[model samples]
Target: MTPPTLMSMMIAGGLIGLGLALLVIWFTPAQPDLNDAVKRLSNTSPHRPDAEASTVNGKERLGIWAMRTLPVGLWAKTPTRELALLRIPLARFYGDKLTYAALGFVIPIGLATFLSLLGLGLPFAMPVIACIALAVVMFFLPNYNAIDDAKKARIEFNRALGAYIDLVALERTNGSGVRQAMETAAGIGDSWVFNRLAEELNRSRWSGLPPWDALHALATELGLPDLDDFADIMRLSGEEGTATYATLRARSAAMRTAMLNDELTEANAIGERMSIPGSLLGVIFMAILLTPSLLRMIPG
Candidate 1:
């Protein structure tokens, strides 16, 4: 074929490919987000405004689009409980992961281009390997971050819950009902945990669901056994009209003790790890000091 005809064919093919890509993007329906569906079903749970379909940001939409396009097995499993505790939307988390993955994909190409410009030809496999490895790492980076953040958040939530239990007990001793004590205790603290509690309580009240049910759901979603126990305690009080001052106080004390023990154990492990480097340094110093003497003692 003549060069001009070949060029014309290539151009037409490129245009056709571009057109097909645009058609797919514009016509494909976005996948329904499971997290949003669950939240919609649960009337009393606090819902983030950004989790709504209409309010999704560009990055979040990118994430949802990728989720829809990719095979289910190819994507990392969604970290629902961690996301719930952190109040991070599933769409936003996916967005962050995909954004990192895109960066991972682009970086190797950029580096290869720069090396090519410098007259350094990398093997074909190098960039491909770097791209896959980095992309996989970057894709899962958000999972690690979410899990770590959730671990810390759980600690904070448990600590705050202990304090809250104390406050509730105080309110109950002052002749307040279960609902009134919980609401009053939730409103007392200024931390995010307290704010979350207050929001859920208010939402439950508005939705006409019992406050204990909301608390229990929140606890189950976030995997908070302490909160679940607190919910059960409140449920008992709410239903049986029983005084719960002693039970609340006992739970609070046990929680505080467990927290203290965990802290101490963690500190001991950290101390053990810290000692290794110092011991190694000391051994190196002794070896350095003894080297000349040992050499002199050897028959020369």
Candidate 2:
């Protein structure tokens, strides 16, 4: 066969072998339920019973030795419940209940020994160490993904908040009070941002708290100063009569401008940080370019 064909066949064969190995693990009677094991690993036990699995000392001693030789501790250390809730399918693609952190510890050592036995000219130890290091990084990747999702959600919510404020102000100008404007605006807006506000307002009304107070509470939880300011203005308007719509519109514009400025400043800071690496690379490149000339000019 051609070189490309041969390489494809080799890759296919390796994948088939891995599939068989996984199948064997799946069929093994003693192997714990992959889902259950992953759950135990993630440690999201809302209601774990006091009972622990009892180990028999007689014939099970051999099994205990076998399990200990494997990276069971690393596997056990994974909080399975959290990973299950996270629902990152990428983690399951490698092996369910198998952590990347556990992979380096398990795979590289096993691989190096197998390769050494086959007399392959491979750096066994390095491959093993590299696998382990990679796994360690993969373990925490879900946290970063969650943070990115939250940031996107927050930005969308903020964008929608400005429009919602304008709609409420328009209703107020039509002779509706603060609460009435909020209720009317919320009823008309079908967006998720509005839905969230409506739900909070509904809850506030049911709980005997003012809708403005609920808005302020949500703002505090979300760390949105603009929403908090709107809530404060509304609370004041209830006592001081309907004259704060202009102030609300002005605040909304100012908040939007402030958010834009913050984004620009952050972009500039990131640009500066990026430059440091480029400057270092430039210095290294110039030094390399001048190396021969400097050597020749130096002594003789």
Candidate 3:
């Protein structure tokens, strides 16, 4: 067999093994342990791991241990900034990467063993290469996930910030101080974005730092330049005694317009992409209808 064909078979076998593993995990029920029994007797609930199985949890623990033993630089290329935006712990991220890598490494080995049992021998190089390639691919899954999640989160946060700017402007127009306006505006909204704003403002209040500084720091950490500009506006309002009601309202309106334009652009691009398949189908249909007529015209 060709190298490409052998590699395809190995990859397919690994995928099949992964599917079987998932099915087994899905159908298997957790057995009660002595600790669970004692907890039930005492009317106290036993804590469950968020992972689907204790074995998976054990794998995560192994991942953690391996990460601690391995060089931190080994995982230095990960999405640390995006992870900060998403508030994922470094250890947990590393653990997830390791768990995925372990699965990728083991699946091919298991497939090789199964093939051997059936008297079909694969070259040692095939499974080895497949294992390494898949492991590398799996290890980066969490990085991609963090980037995508942070991207969506930033969009939501920016949408909320436009309203937040308007709310703060309204509060300022009511004769509230800069700090009071920020706190009151943050309290008015019930979204998680507002909760984050409230938390940061409260932290700044406790730490004796200016609210604008805290906001600026948060913006820098989360890559929200809109929030950073808002912080600068608030800073001017607080330190220089400038009126920001008009400025804040203007900024909010501009942000809303930008967001709307972005949505329209994305929709247009999607429609353009979707037209390709429709155009292809139309061409295929026209060809089918004309093929017999063209053949008859040829006078066979």
Candidate 4:
């Protein structure tokens, strides 16, 4: 057999194997064990829907399979934390990464194969290298997106939290207890962040835990150190019999100022970035305008 024929057969076999694997995965029922079902039922939070768990599609199933089969312990841990902060489930996060990586691998290889079939005569190693490089990059793309999303979510949550602190302080000034003030403030807002607070507070009420404890637990789970600090302040008010109204108000004000400073810093950075493109355009324009004059002076 010719070298080209052997290579073609091998590629064909690989494609067939991949297709069969996908088909098998698609047709297979993912039976939830008793433990998984119980865990799913018990883990429902008011702020996030249970429907997210039920909405897994075939591609996601494939990704889940990949995640289960691969020994990606170190790689999965960091992204899992980031995804949790973004309120994305671990299964879905893994699925997204796997899907991106698959696309990255398939696209370059397919393109190279098409070019080869069209007689482009490219070297074999180039496509293999490109496929690996693209796959690695695409695999990490979801992690980057999750990090950016988590950062934005934290910023928004902090802003809402500041407002919540102010509300709680106002309620406290009106003679409400710490818990009552937190519940009242949380109930006043329709935002997701506020809803999350209300959910945690309600859970604390149900579980016989203190509101501060619930907030601390949530902060720990979501990697929000600011929430932990707020929890500490509440703890101090409850345990030390301190007047917390002024403290809450001051904290709210400080948070707002910090947020404003961050916004201004980001705005200035964006303005600086905008100047770079403007400068590049100016240079390009100058070059275009000068090119003809320079050519004229070339003594042609």
The best candidate in terms of lDDT: 1
List where candidate 2 sits over 4 angstroms from the true fold. Answer: 1-136, 187-191, 206-208, 239-242, 273-289
Who is ahead in lDDT, 1 or 3? 1
- Pick by TM-score: which candidate is best? 4
lDDT (tens digit, per residue) of candidate 4 on 74-134 = 3554555466566676666777787788788778768866876887745667767888899
Q: Cα RMSDs of all predictions? A: 5.4, 11.8, 9.8, 3.1
lDDT of 1 by residue, 19-96 (tens): 575456545555667776786767655554323445666666666776677787866588889987887767678778
Each prediction's Cα lDDT score? 0.82, 0.62, 0.80, 0.78
Count backbone overlaps in model 1. 0
Model 2, span 243-263: residue lDDT tens:
877987887788689779989
Judge candidate 4 at residue 211 and give its lDDT. 90
Worst 10 residues of 2 by lDDT: 43-52
User: What are the clash counts of all predictions, listed in order?
Assistant: 0, 12, 0, 0
The C-alpha local distance difference test score for the whole of candidate 1 amounts to 0.82
TM-score of 3: 0.77
Give residue 98's lDDT in candidate 1 (0 to 100): 75
